[model samples]
Target: MALRAHVGKLRVHQAASEVAVESVSLARRFRGPGAAERGDQLVRAALSVTSNIAEACGRGSVAEFRQFLLYARGSAQEALSQLDIARRLEPPMLTTVIRRLESRSALVIKQLGRLHDNPPRQR
Candidate 1:
C-alpha cells in the first residue's frame, strides 16, 4: 500500500499532524527575547511527534509501531513542556495560542498512548 494511504488509516496520525501544524502556527507568532530559539524547539518537537508516527506506520510489525508511538508520545510531551515555558515567558497576548497548542499536544499524547497500549494487529 501507498505510504499516504497507510498513514491515513491511523487516527493518531491525523491528531499528530494537527498538532504539528498548530505548533508551526504558534511558533510563527512568537516574538520578543528568546522567542526565536524557543519557537524552534517547539516546532521541532511538534514535528517529531508526527514524523515518529509516520515512521511507526512504515514499520514491519505491531511492536515496532508501538515503539515509534512511544517516541511520538515523548515528542508530544516535549512540545507540551515547551508550550508551558512559552506561556510563562511570552506576553499575555500569546496565552490563547499557547493554550490551544498545549491542548492539541495533550490529545496527541493520549492518542499515542492508546495506540501504544493496544496496537492494531499487523497485516
Candidate 2:
C-alpha cells in the first residue's frame, strides 16, 4: 500500500474517534482528586492517536508516516495506561469504556504494523 492508501483506512479514524469519545466519557466519570489531570492526559493521548496519523498521511515519505504511526502507538499506550489508573480510581463503568478503547487501540496498532512491515507498491 502507498502511504496515503494505508492511512486512508477508515479503521484508523474510527479507532481514534472511539478513543476520543471514551476519553471524554472517562473524564466525566472519574471525578476525584487529580481526576482533572488524568482526564487531560487521556484527552491529549486520544487526540494524538488520530492527529499523528493525519499528519503522517500528509508527509512526503513513507518513512515519515511510519514515524508518526509510531508516535500514535505511543499515544495509544499512554491512553491505555491512563485508563488503567482510572480503573483503579473510578467505578467499573469506566472500565467498560476503557476496555473498548483498548481494543480499538490494539486494532490500530495492528494496522500500523501491517503498513510499516509491507512495502508500498512501486510507481
Candidate 3:
C-alpha cells in the first residue's frame, strides 16, 4: 500500500492530534506559581505523542514504525501523568476537562500498543 494511504487510515494519529491540541489549550489555563514550567512540560509531552506517530508513519520499515510507536506510547503516558498532576493543582472547575484529556490519552496509549503489536504490512 502507498505510504500516504496508510497514514490516512491511521485513526490513532487523529486522536493524538486532538490530544495535542487539547493539551495546549489546557496548559493555557494554568496560572499560578510554577504554572509556566508545568504547562511547558505538559505541552512537550503531549506534542511528542503526535510527533512520534508522524515520524513512525514516515519511516520505511515496520520495525522503525513500531519503535516510534513505543516512543509515542511513552509520550502519551507522560502527558497523562502531567494531566493527573494538573488535576491536583488546578481548581475544581478544571477537573472535568483534565479528566477528559486523561481519557483521550488512555485511548491513544491503547491504540499505539495495538499498532505496535500488529503493524501494517509493507508491500
Candidate 4:
C-alpha cells in the first residue's frame, strides 16, 4: 500500500508537470487538430493508472489491491496507446517522457503482481 501510494503520487506529479509544460504549446499549435483531444486523453489515462492503484490500496484488502492493479495495468496500456497516437501528432521530444513513464508503469505492474502472488508479512 505504501509503495503504491508513493508511486501513485510520483506518477501524478510527473504527469501533471509534463502536461503543464506541453499543454500550452500543444494547445496553440494543435488547437484545431485532433491531437488536442488525444493529448488530454493520454494525460488523464496516465493519471487513472496511478489514481486507481492508490484508491485500491486504501481498501486494505489483498483482493481489492489485485483488482485495482488490474485497472492500473489496463490504464497503462491505454496511456501507451494514446502515446502512440500522440507521437504522430507531436514532436519527437516527447519520446523520452513517454518512455520513462512507460517503464515506470511496467515496473509498477510487476511489483503489484509480486505483491498479489506473495504478500509481505504484517507486523
Which structure is stronger by TM-score: 2 or 3? 3
Q: List candidate 2 segments past 4 Å from native.
A: 1-3, 6-8, 119-123
Candidate 3: stretches off by over 4 Å: 1-5
Pairs in steric clash, model 3 = none
Over the stretch 1-123, how does candidate 1's per-residue lDDT look in tens digits?
Answer: 222226788888888888888888888888888889999999999999889988988887777788888998999999999999999988899999889878878887888888788776654
The 10 consecutive residues of candidate 3 with the worst lDDT sum are 1-10
The CA-based lDDT of model 4 is what?
Answer: 0.58
Against the unseen true structure, what C-alpha lDDT does each candidate score?
0.85, 0.75, 0.90, 0.58
Ordered list by TM-score, greatest first: 3, 1, 2, 4
Cα lDDT, model 1, residue 50: 86
108 Cα displacement, candidate 4 (Å): 2.9
Q: In candidate 1, residue 7 scores what lDDT? A: 77
Model 4 sits at a Cα RMSD from the real structure of 5.0
Selected candidate, larger TM-score, 1 vs 2: 1
Candidate 4 C-alpha lDDT tens digits along 1-123: 332334344444354345334433443443336766876776677667657766665656566666876786677677667656665666776666655655655565566566556543332
Error of 4 at 99 (Å): 3.0
Q: What are the models' TM-scores?
A: 0.91, 0.84, 0.94, 0.63
lDDT of 2 by residue, 1-123 (tens): 444444566567677877787778778777879988988998898888888877777676777777877888888788878877877888776677777777777777777677656635433
Give the lDDT ranking, best first.
3, 1, 2, 4
Clashes of each: 0, 0, 0, 0
Which model scores highest in TM-score?
3
Candidate 4, residue 39: CA error in Å?
A: 1.4
- Give residue 94's error in model 2 in angstroms: 2.4
